[model samples]
Structure formats: C-alpha cells, structure tokens
Target: MNKLIGKKKITMENAFYLLKRIGFYKALKNIWNHNFEKSFLNKRFEQMISIEEKKGKEEKNEKLLIDLCECYLSLNNRFSSEILSICVPCLLKVGLKKDETDETQKEVEMTLLALSEIGYWEMKRGLYLNEIEAIIRYHHEHHNLSRLAYQSAWQFLIFRIYKDYSLEDVIVNELHFGREAARELKELRESVDWKRKEERGKEAKEVIVIWRWINAIDNYLTWCALWSEELVGFLGSIVQVFREVKDNHREVIYKCIYSLKNAAESRVIKVEELLKNEAVDVVLEEIHQPKLYDKMTYECLLFFLHISERLKEKEYFESDDKVRKTSKRVIFEKIEEEGYEDIISSFLETFDSLNIKLYPYLSLKISDYFVNV
Candidate 1:
C-alpha cells in the first residue's frame, strides 16, 4: 500500500476500497484513531519539512510529497488546524515555480492541492481563521502564484470565509483584495476569446478563475459596489459575456443576471448604468425565455423589482422630477413593451412549483408596478 501510494498508483478512494475488500478497513481506522491521538501524522509532516530544510536541496522528493498528501487526505479532521499551520507555510515557501524542473513544479502543484483541500476543510467547519488569513496574505504578497492557486485562494475568500467572517472583516477591511481581484477579472475578460471554442478549451483554467471572481463579486456585491471603482465595468463585462455565451451557457447567464440583480439590490449602481450596459434588456430577455428554471425566473423578477424601486426613489427624490419621471416612464415602457406583464403572469401561475419563498411577493410587486405604470 505504501509503495503504491508513493508511486501514485492508488487514489484515496481506491485505497479504502481495497482495505474493505481485505477486511482491514476497521483495523486501519483503529490505527488512524490511535495516530490522531498521538498527533503522529502531524509529526510526520513536520519531520518531512525539517528534513527538507536540513538537506538544502532545490529538488524535492515528489513521490514522498505525493504520499504525504495522500496521508493528509486520509486523516480525519481532528488535527486539521495543526496540519494546516504546517502545510500553509510549506505551500508558500514552495511558491509555484514557473521556470523550475518538472519534478520541482510537480512538487509545488501537489503541495498546493494538499493545502487547498485542508484550507477548504477548515473553511467549511468555520475553524482556523488565522491560518486562512495567512494563505490570503501569502497570495497577496506573492503575485507570481499560478492561476490554480489564485482560484483556490479567491474561492476560499468568496465562498467559505463568509461562513465565519463578515463582509466587513474580509472585503471591507481588506480593500486591496477587492481591487486586485477586479484587476484580475478585467485582465481575464480581455484575454479570453469568448467566441472561439478552441480558445476557451485552451484557457479552461482561466475561465474557471474568471467565474470564481464573478461569484465573489456576486457574493459581496454591496462591498464591490461601494469599494470597487470597476463595478460598472464589472457589470458591463457580465452583460457582454451573457450576450456572447447566452445560448450554450445558460448557467453563466444565470450567474451574470444574478450579479446584476445583486448590483441593483445594492442600490449603489445607478439604473442608468444598468440601462447603458443593456442589463435591463438582458434580464427581460431571460425572463421571456420559453423555459427557465424557477430560480432563474426568480432572479429575473427580483432584478426588475429592484430596478423599479430605484426608479421610484429617483421619481420621489430627484431635483428634476420631470426628468426622473420621464426616465422612469421610459424604463417602465421598455419593461411593459418587453411583455414583462406576461412574464409576471407566467411566474404567478407556476408559483406553487417554485422553490423560492419570496417568489409570490416579488411577482406581485412587479405586477403592481405594471398596473400603475
């Protein structure tokens, strides 16, 4: 088993399956339980790192590292924090070399994948905020990390950190994180040839990273709106991506519209900005689609609700009531002309089937707007 693990011949799942077939699974679990008590695995990790530092060699033992990663995955979560404390520094020190030997690069990639899994585990349990901070700090300080590493770090921030930390703790306090992420998003948007299938396949890793950033923005829209100078450009990029990939990538369109919906709810982005970016047309077109899932339909409806609320605020508060009213009138006409009434009716008719609890209220709000418009 050790030979196979060191040789990367067996996966964690395969190892477990083999153990069960041989009826050693329970015995191995007992062994692991004992090791967990003694912190044996953690000590092994520390010993490996200590030996590496003492040797002072540029080439890493890739097979040993792969074996260690497998061992890390097999262990329970009891010593996760300790393991992460050891693994995080190792990952940073390795630093994802681009101009290194294949063996060294493989070692770095394996180390990163191991640390990412550990970090994700900690994030899911809402433990080890300090260690999470360390990873984020390392990513910020070391700009030369690979895209896979960047994606993992951002996903931890955008998806998991919010479980324990607030938007203010991470997004607001760490303002540069948002800006750097926006810059990365812009560069990714420009670099991709969205029209070419071959290009997308070639840049699949980057495309995944781009979606992670979009999701981060969607998750923290209020902060992005208040802090990101590129919020308008972010919205424009989403709409543009939606227009380019609307047919084949409905999921991407959903995320884009959801981000726009979040932008509307933030109340930081102007309705005119949305209109200028064709966000209104995008939502209308989605809602008018012949078949949309309930959640997608709900996002489209909520988008209109928020947009109308913004327009209503302008109608009441703006110094030029005539201009505000005319703007609101034109938008309402656009919605009405786009047959939003039918969309609302369709949603109401299928309200019982929708998974969203707020669907009925949202439907009525938009319905009232159309009736009064």
Candidate 2:
C-alpha cells in the first residue's frame, strides 16, 4: 500500500496493470477493506474512500473507475451517514467520465447501476433527497435507468411523506432540503411513465426489482399509489408472493396490505382496476394460501370485506363466471384442507364474533356456496 502511494502518484498504465494483476474484484473488496482480499486487512471503507478521492479523477483507466463505482455501490447501506457524506459525491463524479471507449461504456453501465444503488439507499432512509434525485435524473429517460430512478424517487417520497419532512436541514436560514429548494417532484413525476417502463425479466428476482419500491407506498403518498391499474399490475406481476411466501411473513404481507391500502386509502384502486388486473382473483387465491391464511388475517379480511362493501350497491356479483369460479374454488380448497364442518364453523364463528353487519359480500357468498354445494 505504502509502495503504491509512496511515489505520490499512480500512472494510468500502472493503475490498469496493478488493478488487473491484483484482480478487479479483489481490488474492489480491498479498496473497501483497506487490505488485499484473503488478508482481512485494516483502515477499511475510509481507506478506500481516501484512495478514490485522491486518484479516482486523475486515473485514466475507465475499468478502475468502474471498479470503484462498484465498490461504492457495495458499500452503500453497509455503513453509516459518514459514508454517504463521502461516498455518494465521489462516485457521481466518477460516473461523469466520458472517454467513450467500449470499456468506458461498460464502466458507465456499472457506474449507472452504482448511482442507482446510492440513490436507492439514500432515499430509503430519507437522506440526500435532492442529490439522490439528481443522480437518478442524470440517467435521463432511458427505460431501465429511468425505471430505477423512479423507483428510488418513489422510496424517497414515501419516507418524506411518512416522516413528514424532506429531511433537509436549514442552516442559518440559508435553507437546504426545504421543499422550495428541492426540484418540482410532482411535475417531474408526470414526465416518466412508470407503467410503460415496467417490463419483466427472465428471472423472478430481476422482475421483482421493478415492483420493490412500489410496494412501499400508502395513503400518505398517493400520486403513484393512485395509479390503481399500475399498482395492481405490479401486484399481479408478483402473484407468486401471495402463494409462495409463508402465510404470515411480514414483508410480503405488508407489501400486499400497503398495495391494497394505497389503492383503498387513495380511492383509485376501483373494482374494474382490481378485476382487470386479476387482483381480485389474487386476493381470493390468497385465502387458500395456508401460510398467508394465518399471517394475513386483517389484510385477507379487509380486502374481501372492502371489495364486497364497495360492490354492494354497484353490481352484487353481476353473474360473472370468474367471480363464481373464484369463490367456489376458495371454498372447496379451504374445506378440503381443514374439514368442511370445521371450515364453516371457524369462519362463521369469527364473523359472528366480529359482529359484522355487512351483507352481499364475497365471504357470505362463499359461505352460502359451502352450505349448499
């Protein structure tokens, strides 16, 4: 370490050679750990930041910059605010390199991903809201980049709404982070079409990233939440969540509740939106998911009750094959799993005890089907 820096400057050629010899991944990890990989060395993240601060701009090797960008992303959310105060700006500067070689383009690709990571972490915890927004916007209107940026922006907005602050502190009345100084988020929002950007990936993990932050919204932030069709579209994309995750799992259940609550509370997730998106069927199916059946008591009940309550004056089931099939399926599977007599007794017992008066809902219809069929 001393030998590399004792000469005071690392030439681009030495930088590239040293990086390749030591290996890109090793160098990236060591840059953060302040020691070669396998040695488990010292000075750690701060040492990496210092090295990048001094040489990141001067180093002409785009690959090195790419490695550093990756290093930055890796370190995000792993450390404290002190890290963000240093790392975020440094990586953004590296991302600005424009040598235009194929290597540099790859460097820029990883660099954009790193920037997205930084933006995402910062926004999730409600720090550097404006700076993170700028990093996201720097990716411009490209679908993938804009999608990530929007998702990060959405996270920041959720925290901002939930905490009721933009998180910018005013200094001596010079005002930073004040809503006035921040960019016009609402107007800026209108430009990026979220639904147009949400395409699927070959893998579920890849596809789920598009909806990761979308699941975080509720009534406190209604702009994107109000897009009931889009929200439900995201919900349908991950119908696997309802079926796969353990019944009472907090993360999946919370996301489901928040999506429903976002629509219900925002007054935009209408029945047509639910039905068109297959969201109703998804909810109906969830009642039969053994794991969720126990974990999502309120969400499961509220979803059906609310939907049923909403439909009471509107259609009264309206003779839809889909509705009948879904209700019948829910009843059959549930009875098969937990004996017909017990299934009927448990639900009706709960409904009677809850003292609910609502009629003309899915639950009652399901109950009636069990009694007759």
Candidate 3:
C-alpha cells in the first residue's frame, strides 16, 4: 500500500497514496467539521520530515527534496499545513545562514509558493477558512517574499473577502485600500519604467492593465476634484500623450477624451477642434465594428450636447436673447434629426431637477409639443 503511492501505475493503493501525498490528510480532517490535531496528521508530517532529513543540506538534493515535499503537501490537509507552517520558517533560517546560494533561495521560494498554492486552493474551493486566514496572515507579515508574494497575498484576501463580505462593507474597505494604492500607483506612473505607450502587438493583459491603471488615475482625479489640482493635471497630461500617438490610438484616445469631457472644469477647445476635424472622423470611420469598451463615439456626441446645454443655461440666465435662442434651436434641430431620445431624456431630467425656466418662447413651444403628443 505504501509502495502504491510511489508507483506511476494505476492501482487503488497508488490512488490513496497520491491523494494522501497531496493534502488528502488535511481535507479528511474537515470531513466531520472537526479541529485538526497533530496526531491526525502525524503520518503526513513524518513523510515530509523524512524527505528533508534524508536529503540533508546538500544543494544538488534541492529538486528531489522539493518534489518529495510537494507530493506530501498536496494532501491539502490542515495537519500537513500546520507541520509545514512550522517547518518552512525554520528551514528558511537554516538554509539562508548556511549558504546564500541559489539552491537556498529556491528552497525559500518553493516553500512559500507551496503555502500560497494551498491557500489559493482552499480559498478557491471554499473550505478551511481558518487555514486560509493563517496562510494570509503569515504571508502578509513577511516583507521579503518578492512582488509576486504581495500580489498573491492581495489576490487571496480579495477573493475571500469578496465571497464573504457584504457589498457595502467591501466598498468601504476598498476605499481605504484604494487611497494608499493610488499614491503608490502615482509614483509608479511617473517613474521612467512605467512606459505609457504599448509596443506593437503587446500582450493583451499588459495593454489592458495599462488602460485600467490610467482609468483608475483618471477616476481618482475626478473623485478627488475639490481636494487637489493633481487630478486635473493628470487628465491634461494624458490628453497630451493621446495627441502624440502615430498609430491608430483611437481606443485609448477616446477613453482619455471621454474622461476629460466628463471631468474637465472648463471645456477644452483643443479637444473640441480635434473632434470636429477630419482626422478624428477618419479614425472613427476605421473603427466600423464597435467594441464593448468603445462608447467614445456616443460619448463624444453626448459631451457636445452637454456643453451646449451648459452654454444655453448661461445665455438664457443672463438674458442674452440671441445666444439663448440660437443655441436652443441648433440643439433641438439636432436632437430631432438624430432621434437622440436618451440624451434628450437625460437633459430634461437635469433641467427638471435644477428647476430651470427655459426662455418663454422655447418653454411655450415644448409645452405645446407635449400637449399635442
């Protein structure tokens, strides 16, 4: 039966051995919702310990040791985690002190990796919450585990919290974390290493992460508008970058322009000129098939209408009769021809909320139209 676990061939004994080797021992510990104890996991611990002891401190023996250790750890048992949880830290101290070698680094990396994998598995499968908590606490406190470690620990906690917490609680907590992360992200963005331009045919993930980070920065600026000049400056800088792209940079350009249109304190004549220019029309034409993420086409039109509405409000309030009448007629005609019911509806809702009295002539005309309808 013991030999079956080591065999490459199929057999009931081999299957049990494979299972026990992986962390089946720990999984079984939870079958009855019982607390994991040392005695219950003694066999798995002994097996893991035996590999390290037999291999000793030899560099060449590292791979063999890792393999044997992984086979034992895969049992996914709390007993195995507890045993490894103690063993790994001790091995790190001994391995680092004896030889600051690649093999030693590998030892530390693999052990932490194993722990991370187990924690991920538990979090993914929705079992052993306490065990997952222990793994996170341990990993989080360790400051030297590489960037991957920080990323891994963050991903683990987020998964568990997302699954377990209420939307309100999660949102409040994210805001706290977001503030700190935003600061760090700002520093990274300004660093020379944080290149904003994508190389031709860069992997989708890299491109997407860049897009999201830029958007996050934009969001932070808009959300913190009254608090700082930084957000506005960041938006302006991004617009400049968008203007420099030689290749078809419409997707990113559209995103930047849309964000600016929503949040810019003053309407940018430069962006307006760009939109009305022949070049932008050519770019928009090329993007005939719209993407899920491509709302720039519609947003640009909406932004123009919004600015027109603001201009109309100002003109009418100042009793500038010609300006108010001209703006209203142009906007009304466009809306009617385009059948932009949604934008028209939003405009009406905002007008209602603000309790704005339109110019008497326009007000009487809209009232008659509604009466006829």
Candidate 4:
C-alpha cells in the first residue's frame, strides 16, 4: 500500500514538472483572454452593422458610428489591421450610397476618424502588407466612391504602401490610382486659400494629411525616377507650395527637401526640370541656413552633388538636348552661377566632420567640377 502511494506521488510530481517546463498555465490564460476579447469585439461589431443597415434611422446611425469609432480607439493597436480589414469595406459601401444628406456627411466624418485611428496604429506598428493590399484592391475597384471615402482609402494606402516600390508601381502603373491621387491632391491644395491667415487656419486641420500624401508621391518618385508627364508636371506646383509655406511649416519643408534630395539622387529628375520649377533657389535658401550637419543640410548637399555629377556626364546631355540652346551647357552654367563652389565646400566639410571614411570617396565624386574648372 505504501509502494502504491509512493508511485502515485511520483506521477503527480512529474505532471507538475512538465506543466512548468512548457508554461502551460500562462499559455492557457492567453488563449482564454484572446478568445474573450475576440468574442466581445465580434458581438459589438455585429450590433453596429445591423444598426447600419436600417434606413431612415439617421440619428441611430450617427450614434452608432460614434460608438464604433470610440470602440476602435479604446482597443489595442495589435488588432488595428484586423479591425481595418473588417471596417473599411462596410464604411466604403455606406459612403457610396447616393444619399447626399446631412446624415451622410456625419457618417463620412465619423468614418474618417475611425479609419485615421486604425491607419495611425497600423503605420506605427509596421503595416501588415497582405491586409493592406487587400484594402487597396477593394479601394481601387471602387475608385469612384464618395470624395471623402476616396481620401480615406488613399490616406491608408499612402501610409502603408509608400515604402514598397513594387506595390507602388502596381498602383501607379497598372491600377492608375496614382493619377487619381494626384488629381485629388491638386484639388485639395487649390481648395485652401493659403495666403489668407483665417482661411489657412480654417484648413489647418487637413494640411498635414495633404502634405503626407504629397510626401508619399515624392517617395514613389524617388524609387521609380520616372512618371507620366502629367505627374511630372505637378512637381512645379509642389515646389511652389514649398515656397509659399516654408517659413511657417518647417517640418513640412524638411520633408519636401528630403524628397527632392532623394529624387535628385535617384537621377530621375534632371537639372533642367528642377530649374524650370525654381527648385535650385529653394535648395540654395536651405543650404545657406545657419544650421549645419542637420537633415536639411545633408539633403541639400547631396542634391547639389548629384546635380553636379549629372552635369558632368556628356552622354545624358546629348541625348536629352532637343530644340534648346545647348541644354547641358546652359544648365551647368546656370548652376555654377548659383555659387555651387560654396555648396560643394559645405558638403565636403559636413561629410568630413560626420565620418572620416565617407569623406574621401564623396570628395572624389564631388571635386570633379572644381577640377575641370
């Protein structure tokens, strides 16, 4: 009888040891919590969807949307992509309904809030590419949806897909969404009276979002280096906007310059194109600023370096020259006239100060113009 009791005790002890080794208790707790949260969110979402389907219940729908936005905000960021995947299609469908009533506007605004929240979270915690692709595909197929809906979808797309060059190409080339996005951005920019203080303040809420979209386009250009002529034509307007708002919006200006620097480095935008838009003047203004070794300084220096190298390449100039008076020579003269020697010195100094290793190779490439001169 004692042997039997001893054997039972040994078996129980072994079971306990195995449980501890594999974290059985913690794993079970996590599974239970996940199931509970999923069930709760599912129930709440289903209730909102049912209310959304009822007609003439505008008051209820408004409250329902408000509650829905609040619920999403209260949830954890880990669920952002999942929530967006479920919510975007439904919100888009409602946005497409042909009822241009006050109720619809409220719905649109609330939906924007919900989407922006999820987008922020998704962007913060690295986007889920597959989920985002699905959203983009659905959005592209329903491109002619309401204006607000279109903006919401594009906002998410820009935030998530900007860094993925292949996906960006699919959107820009095959899908043609890039053209649509550019048109919308142009309209949005035109809508604001940027010169009027009161009007600027009134539109300030949307300014950041608009700039973000622009930055995304600029990023895409950095990768592809070439876009349709219409899209390329829009670069001038972008530079013009930078000139107008640079003083008041330093962060926005930094992003604009950074994009220009990357675009120049990519060798896609020629010096002549930049000159036509007065981009050189913009870069010069930033270059002369007191702040040294900053992002703007680095970007401006690199911009000039790339431009100078392109100027040195005779083949590029010969192929591109068409009906213009020695396009390459004229462009080189124009840039030199802007005091590029000082810009080169600044670049060399800044790079040398930052890292001893990079200075030699960079100087070799950058000093070519001075050598030829």
Candidate 5:
C-alpha cells in the first residue's frame, strides 16, 4: 500500500477509497508496514472523522463510513491522543447505534472493532471517560454488538488505567492486595447492575446483555494481573451461571471462558482457588462439550498458553529455579495434572487451522508456541 502511495500521488479520499477496496485487516497491515510521511493518513483520518460527525448519522452510508472508520483504525495504534479522541463522538455513535439492516449490521460490527482497536492505544488526554463509559452501560449489548462494544470499552479502560498502575501492580491489585480496589470494583459492578433485570427470568436480550457485560468485564480484566476477592467472587458467579448454560446460551459460555482466561493466564488467582471454586474445571468441561463453538474451543487452547506464560513470568512452576523459562514442559505440568493434555492438543490443532483475523498478537503467539511445542 505504501509502495502504491509512494509511486503515485494519492489524495486523502483516494487513500480511503483504496483502503475500502483492500479491506480492514490488510489496511492495518499496510499501515504497520509502511510509514505515511507528512501525516498523510492522519489528515485522511481526520477528514473522514469530520465527515462522519457532520453527516454519518444523518445519512448512514454503510460502505463509506465502515471503510473510513476502519482506515482510521488501521493507523490507530500510532495515532495521537487528539486523533484517537475523535472516536467517541465519531465512531462510537455508529458503533453504539442499533443496526437497521443486515448489511448495515456488519458495518456496525466493523465500526465497533475499529473503536476497540483504537481503544487498545493509550489515551493520554483522558477525555470522554463518561461518553465511553456510557457506551458500555447503554449500548454495549445493543443486540448483537455486545462483544465488540464491550471489548472496545475494555481496551479503553485498560489503556487509561495503565497510566496509574504498573502492569505488575495492576495484577496485584486485582489479586490479594486489593481490598480498597475491590470496593471500587464492586461499585463499578453495581453501576451496571445487570443482574437486577437478569433475575426476573431468561429474556434472551436481557440475558445476553447481562452475560455480555459479565463476559466483557472479565475479558477486559483478563489482561490485568490484578485479582481481588470481589473480582474472584464476580468470576465465580459467572462460573455458576456457566454450569446452567444451554445451546441458546452459547455466547454466555463463550464469555464465561473469556472471563476465566485471565485467571488461567495470570495465575494471580492461584491453582487452589481455581480448583476450590471449580472455575478451571467448569471451563474445561465447557470447552470439551461437543456443542461449544469452534472459536471458543480455539480460545480455550490459546489461554492454556496464557496460563503457562503467566506462571513463567511470575516465576511459578519453575523447575530450573534460576532462569525464567517459558518452556512447554512447565505448561504441560499443569495440563497433565488437570488431565487436559489430549484436549489441549486437539484444540491447539483446531486453533492453528482456523483463519483468525482479530487478536493478531495472540495469533503470532500461537504460531510461535506450536513451532516450539
């Protein structure tokens, strides 16, 4: 893409149009691979955002708007805080809105993905916390848009919180030393209050939204090493909910696994706690269920690595006692103890074969793990 740009004089509109043609994922790769001098992409992104703010809701051009937001996201990782700030008003409006058609719906999905990717970048200005938080509270589970919305919001919060907490401390705060943090988290949990409506009965939309938030919060929390009693208790609640999951409850189970992944990945929650609470066992049972989605199964395998890597990072389960080693043997020790080797092998094979698009970082990690395994 940069080759084309360098060889030809491409206008901002043309660049966006070409990005629209090449697709979102490729556009991201293109931006990552090449440097657009003189803020070429930045100007284009600002222009598209300007247009979206001025006309996006009034006249929703599905193709153009989707491509534009995706183009901005393609360069989002390096985008300035000022540029990233445009997301709430511009992209979130489209992302958070309920879709009017199947075509428009997919575009909306892409828009939320764009927002999420942008959120993955650190927000230095700290603007629009209320607006972005509103996305989670009001629009996160807007029909089928929950995963992307929740993910976007989660990334946003994670990046912002990183400013104040060390990664190690973030993990620590979420774990044993987080009594005050637990209270804050509890209030945050109460703010959503998803269960107030959930206990009424299993209305699918309400159930999905409730579970979606549960799933989203956990997924967001997974990356942090932080584990508090409140957080653990919250996760245990999801595990209980997972035990009763039915076929229509596929998303619920998927989110449940997503929530458990942090515990698995970080090891901050501890093996005894996982067993005592039955979190690990319940997730493993769900993973092996024939009815579980293939994508969920893939993530199950992916998170096994998550668990082992965290142990390696924190110097747990180390046989060498000296150097930090991320060895397969260390991972398998836990896997073997849990009777998970065969299922893990099968799921990793399944995860390897799939054409995954999101979580490129995890995809690369999976490939490296397989090569070394």
Candidate 6:
C-alpha cells in the first residue's frame, strides 16, 4: 500500500489510499491482547520497516507509520527488546539520510522511546553495563540521532555516558560535549511558545501524529537542560520561557520553575535573578493563597530554595548583593516571624550537602539572628 523511496514523497496504493485510521486508544487496547508474541512482533516490524522504506517518497505514509509504531509500542513488553534493537538503528539509518519525511521523524521518536525503554529495562535487569559502553559509543558516533529522535535521547545518551564513564572522565572528556548538547536543548525551549504552539494545539491539525515527535523533542531538550551546566549561559532565555508560561498557566509555570530550580541545583545554570524576581514572588503568592487543586506550591518552594542555596554557595553572581541580601533577610524573617522552619532549613541543608559556601556576612547575620531569636 506504500511505495516510498529515499527521501521523496509518499505514494499510497488505491487499496490503502482512503484509509480511515483507527484511534490510538483503540489501537492501544488491541495491541495489548496480542501478548507481544514473536510472530506478531516480527510481522509488525517488517511491515513498519517496509512502509518506512516506501514512505520517504510520500508524506502521507508518515502518519500511518507513526500509528503502526505506537500500536507496536502498546503491545506487550515481551518483544520490546528485540524490536527496539532493530528499530533504533533503522530509525537512525532513515533519519540521518537527510530526508524530510515526517514519517522519518516519527520513526525516530519511536526509536528513541524504544531505546529508552530498552535502557530502563536493561538497567533494571542489571545487564546495563555490558551494553552501556557500546551504547555510549554508538550514541557518540551517531550523535546526529539527537535531532531525529525525541529530544529525550540526549538524557538517555547522557545517562548512558555517565554510566560508562567516571565523574572525572566525564569532566575531562565528555563535559564540553555534554554542555554543547545542553545548548541544543535551549534552542528547543525557546521555540515551544512560538506561534506554532497555537497551531499545533489545534485538535483538528493534521500533523497530530507528528506532534508526538515534537513533544518528545521538548521532553528531551528539557532533560538535556536539566542535566548540563551549559544552561547557565542561557539564564535569560530560561527565565523568559518560564515567565511566558507563568503568565498563561500558573500551575504549569510553577512546575517549570521547579524544573529550573532542579536544573540550577544540578549546576545546569546560574539562575539567581529568575528565582529572586517575580517568579519567586509568584510562588510566595501561591503559597499564601494555598490552592488545594494544585499541591505543587511546596515543591516549587523547595526548588526555589534549593537553587537559591546553590547560588549562594557557588557565588556565581556575587555582585548581586541585593538578591543575596534580600534572600537571607526573607528567610530569616520568615523563620523568625511564623516559625516556618523550612525556609532557612532547606537552604542550609542543601547548601551543606552540596558543599556550597554562602556570603560570610550573610551567613553570620543569619546565624546571629537565629542564635538570639
């Protein structure tokens, strides 16, 4: 039904041309009953690859191929390892060929997800180390796969690299490259709310299947941003994206703020201004109002405190005496006035654990105040 060659167009035969595609939910349920048996999994992979080979010639087959991948994913995990092993390389082969088939991107996402699942399963089975070095080498060689698959591949790759290499080795050999990958993530973050977001949000939009690929991109990019220090270079952009989302969706914005906090604490960035500015104020406002529907207020506060503590210790922006002074004053006052112990305690705890040093004056003042009050 599909005739695709290289990176061209999708030509569908009359038999499959006017297809009324089944819904993902229905397909998901249907695949589950198949038990992921060998014959069914092999047949599915063969059909998927056959279609992908023919799909580069036309774009329509892209949607069908993506659907097939999802259906295969929803099937039992029995076939996941083998299916993924074949699919991962196949997707790389197709995606790296300079083709523009939406199907190719779709397949790339399927492959990344499959690999992630495989990696997770392997880790659980404690069989990860045997293949981890090979996986890292493969990822390093095919780093271009970063663009084709879900952005989460970056994290998968980083996790793999971390598993294979020691901390000192990562700091020496892979750190720079890891930071570069994190920069690529920043680009993806900046594009999320572009005008395309609204168009992409439209339910009737035809590229619905391809949209999954986009989401995977976002997740992967966010993961990279979460795991690397290169993010510190884009503090302004991260704040801007957080503000954009915060203005529209408070809850999601808070979560993003927390993510930024975790990333910053991981030494991904130096984001004092972001946490010290209106974003922190927003968190304070939410804390005061106390919405039961969304209980992430405490989590956001913890994230804020963690990053703030990190910055204080690292002294990345020592010149911002105002932010530093204000944060200490706020925490001291909060602890003193309401007996809300978490404010200073969380900061102190994270600071001690990370071995980050705070300003001598600020530290002395807080200690003295606590000693007296």
Top candidate, metric TM-score: 1
Across 1-373, the per-residue lDDT of candidate 1 in tens digits comes to 6457457789745764453333222222223343442564346554664454345346776444444443454343344455445445445455434445666654444444334433224433334345445655665775545655565555545544444445444544563554566567667767777777544343765666666567767766744434444456677777777777676656667778888898777755666677778888888888888888778877877787776666667544323666556667678788778878776876675555553554455644335435244
User: Worst ten-residue run, lDDT, model 6?
Assistant: 14-23
Relative to the true structure, candidate 6 reaches a TM of 0.47
Q: Model 2 over residues 75-146: C-alpha lDDT tens digits? A: 343434555555555455544554556665555444444444332233344334455455444444333333
After superposition, the stretches of candidate 1 with alpha carbons farther than 4 Å from their true spots are 1-90, 95-143, 159-183, 186-201, 222-225, 313-327, 356-373
lDDT of 4 by residue, 1-373 (tens): 1233245755433532342333222321222223423555445544554555454654455544544433443232334445455455545444444445676654554454345334333333233444444545655665434444455555555554534455556556654655665576666667766676443443764465556556556645655644545555555666766776665666667767876776566555655677677776688777776664365665676676666676666675424545133544555675578776776665665576544533332444456534132
Q: Please state the error at residue 36 of candidate 4 in Å.
A: 19
Per-model TM-score, in order, reads: 0.63, 0.44, 0.30, 0.60, 0.45, 0.47
What's the lDDT for residue 265 in model 5? 59
Assess each prediction's global lDDT (C-alpha) against the native.
Answer: 0.58, 0.42, 0.39, 0.53, 0.52, 0.41
Looking at model 6, residue 5 earns an lDDT score of: 21
Clashing pairs in 5: 171-225, 171-226, 174-226, 174-227, 174-228, 175-227
Q: Give lDDT tens digits, candidate 3, residues 123-161.
A: 322233334344434443443433322333333334333
Count of steric clashes across candidates, in order: 0, 3, 9, 0, 6, 8
Q: Lowest-scoring 10 consecutive residues by lDDT in candidate 5?
A: 174-183
- The lowest-lDDT stretch of 10 consecutive residues in candidate 4 is 24-33
Candidate 2 deviant stretches above 4 angstroms: 1-43, 50-69, 72-78, 93-205, 210-258, 265-278, 289-293, 296-299, 302-373
User: Total clashes, candidate 2?
Assistant: 3
lDDT of 3 at 264: 25
- Candidate 1 local lDDT, residue 276: 78
Candidate 4 accuracy as lDDT: 0.53
